[model samples]
Target: MIIKIAEIEEEVVFSGIICADRFKSDYENVDFFGPVEYSLKIGRSDKRLSVKGHVQCSLNLLCARCLESFRYEIDSDIDLQLLPREMAPTDIDLELERDELDVRYYDQDEIDLTELIEEEVILNIPMRAICKEDCKGLCEKCGGNKNLNECKCESGRDTRMAQLLRSYLEEEGDGHGGSQEKAIKVKKG
Candidate 1:
């Protein structure tokens, strides 16, 4: 991901990088691994500097249903101006803003873009991972892994009436099944 200063002449550079999922920060939510690609273009024109490029890559994720790994690829683009590190225009008695496309410095002259790519990829990851688009998740009873085994753990309540009653109350408040008002009605009726 390092580009030498002398190479910016209207030519594009293509390269590959190993995107460690951990580097994505948020990527640790789901275990994953894989490769990333980047294409960069850099050049300068008087007081104006240009940094235009894009990145593309894929990542492996664990399927929530089967708990297996799968690949998900995505792409991103970048077009930006190169600004001065932290010097002021007034200090130089110049008309430009204190933080403009730097008549003085450039990014490649200092900062590296490795961190930028890692950030974009993590943001692009899918919120949910399914081995197959329509995978049947695990069975909640008998501790069975639905993708691998079958169990007689009644797909129904399979619990004592008292336990089911407690669970019903808990789930009702969870805002998924029905509201707490419905739970009170059920208890009374």
Candidate 2:
């Protein structure tokens, strides 16, 4: 949905439901099977356009641990300042002020709500998603999903430590020459 700045007089309030399917191409990795309800108030103060809104949606995300798909709901608050390209500073080396973090520059007179919604949805997703707090994840050895089924692979020793111990025991005559010879003979026997 594109909001034309020219259409607005001084201030306007808009509220509608945007189909989540519209953002399917934007978020190819995740699935959105719900509508995004949004209510925004756009007002112009001098050359700056202030936008405040609320967006809510549901998403189907894959659990990072068990690799199972689950539904997750998102409700995000939108507070932004839209500045014209000419008013924005051109210096890339300059540090941004604290308030400038939420400021977005617009090259054209229209603002694309689709891009904004996509960004908010992606940002709201957790860094690491798990189906449950006690999710048992997959078995490293047998590649079995531990949450669903148990595996026979040994789970006590760390794989890295076991590899190191095996490498040390297989080394030929590393200081304990006689002990190494006896160990090799016992293995063959």
Candidate that would win on TM-score: 2
Model 1 lowest lDDT segment of ten: 180-189
lDDT of 1 by residue, 93-172 (tens): 46355335323344545435576566555555555545553444566655566666667675465569855785565444
For each candidate in turn, the TM-score is 0.49, 0.70
**What is the lDDT of every predicted structure here?**
0.53, 0.69
Poorest stretch of ten by lDDT in candidate 2? 180-189
* lDDT, residue 53, candidate 2: 90
Q: Which residues of candidate 2, in runs, are more than 4 Å off?
A: 92-95, 98-100, 126-128, 155-189
Clashing pairs in 1: none
The global Cα lDDT (0 to 1) of model 2 is 0.69
